[model samples]
Target: MNIIIWNCRGVLKPSFKKRVGDLVQNHNPAILVVMETRVGGDKAREITNLLPFDGAIHTNTIGYAGGLWVLWNTDRVEIALLSKTEQEIHTEVKVRLTNLSWILSAVYASPRNAERQVLWENLMSVADLHNMPWVIAGDFNEPLLSEDKFGGRAVSVNRSLLFKECLDKCNMLDIGFAGPRFTWSNRREVQALIQERIDRFFVNPSWCVMYPNAKITHLTRCHSDHCPVLLEMQPRIQNGRSRPFRF
Candidate 1:
């Protein structure tokens, strides 16, 4: 199955639906995570209902800032909400008609360093609790390595160090990607442009063993400053059924 994660910036734009439809048509993701929705309440619910998904769960936007929506089709997989904060959503995903299961965390980290520290701490807590095959992906808003940014002030040492420490402690490894190295850009003139590979997928070792053929791609950026990331896994045949996930 395919899982798509995108920092769409806002879902209220006129082209939002079309962009989403294109994504669905092109990728056919079983699970889709939209970050920085910037809309909430009844309006958010109404918009989500119009999407071509069977079910969804969301975190409301705080004022005009962050919001997150995790949408899925029940026929593809069964997703059970585990926990959530404004910065993250944890879920257990079981591929339909198969015994395969795993944990998926969709993250939309804050741009502020202090708040990001809190996100790190919370993820550590999650790491301490679960030992399942796990995949954590989204817009971290902070580059994990110096090479992850270009034409911008260097990544902060203290912040990147903390982020590295969190990954070390959590035993999560970056799965890497195909396509463009950077997933986000400032969209400014070349002389003033800033780009970073802030969006990514990190998987625990067990997850690697489960879907050894899993691959990630950084799709071209369009409806948002950030690129929509697609994770595709090779299918595993059991009896006469195929488990696409092999989330």
Candidate 2:
């Protein structure tokens, strides 16, 4: 199974549908987590229904600001909503074929430090709610390491401490990526450009043990400032044989 996480910024743009279609065609993800949609209410429902997914759920936008949508193919996996906030959605996902189940969180953290602290607290509480395998992915809006930023004000270790601590407490590991080092960029002249690897996937030890060959790829940014991240839960098999491993 595969999942795609992206901060599409807004779903009202003319190209939005086509971009989604491209993502579906290229990646064939069983689930798509969209953040910062900047749309809600009746329009949100209409647009979501038209998307190429079997089912979907939307967290209403907070007056043109944050919004989230988790779309999935019911044929591939079954999703049960657990809890949600303007910044996050927690769900239990079960793969239809193997009957494997896990907790999946789609996050769109606030840009403000104080709000993020609340988010951290909420995540920790949710972590304690269950002992199942867990995987979280989304636009965290904060880089966990200094090297995660480029051409911007230096990342502050003090500011990142809470996020790191949250991950440590939750036993979440940053299942590494295979593409560009950075996942988001401020589109601007070179002299004013800023970039950071804020979008990512995190998994608990049980999840890592379940899908040992899980892979993440940071796809090229097209319609949004953030790159779409793809997670493949199993290694690909070619010609009825497992592909050779590489370092």
Candidate 3:
């Protein structure tokens, strides 16, 4: 089934809810992960209920900075929460009609470089917790390669190296995306402009064996600096169900 991960900026704007609904209608994702929601648990619950999903789990906002929520259509997929933190939501998802099951984690790493090191370590720790096929996704706030960014100041080689080291430690490979090469922008002009591919998915070797054709798409965005990311498994899906995804 298709799964979506996005850094919505925040859902407090007047048009945000409708935009979210439109995305849901268009994509029909089995599970939707939203980051940087900037809302508390109560508000998150209210917002997720407006979508087509039947189940919701969220992490509360710290002041007005960070928040995360995972919404899922329970009828098609079953999810059991393994853990939750300010940085991520870890769960095991199983498809009802088949022996298709895997560990799916959604994470929003810290904007601060120092904190991101810890976040990276935490992600590796999660990898250690399970031997199942694992797919971890979201806005990591760091690019793996210098070419993964454009229109920005020179990419930090050290930062990217640290992130790469983290991935190597976990033995995960990035499941590259289609559509836009850059998923985020500074919305500035000329010398101040910046764009980067910071949101993505990384999967373990087991995942490749399970769904060899899995891919992610950098989707269109209407109200945020970051484009929403969609991960579709096995049929090399482009957008929505037209390209079906199995387990």
TM-score of each: 0.93, 0.94, 0.92
Evaluation by TM-score, superior candidate among 1 and 2: 2
On the 0 to 100 scale, the lDDT of residue 36 in model 3 is 93
Worst 10 residues of 3 by lDDT: 238-247
lDDT of 2 by residue, 159-245 (tens): 788888898777898767778999999988999999999998999989988987888889989999999999988848422323322
Error of 3 at 142 (Å): 0.6
Deviating ranges (above 4 Å) for candidate 1? 235-247
Show pairs that collide, candidate 3: none
Residues 84-106, candidate 3: write the lDDT tens digits.
Answer: 88888899999886769999888
Give each model's clash number: 1, 0, 0
lDDT to native, each model:
0.87, 0.88, 0.83
- Report how far residue 214 has shifted in candidate 1, in Å: 0.5
- Pitting candidate 1 against candidate 3, the one with the higher lDDT is 1
In candidate 2, what residue range of length 10 has the lowest lDDT sum?
A: 238-247
User: lDDT winner among the candidates?
Assistant: 2
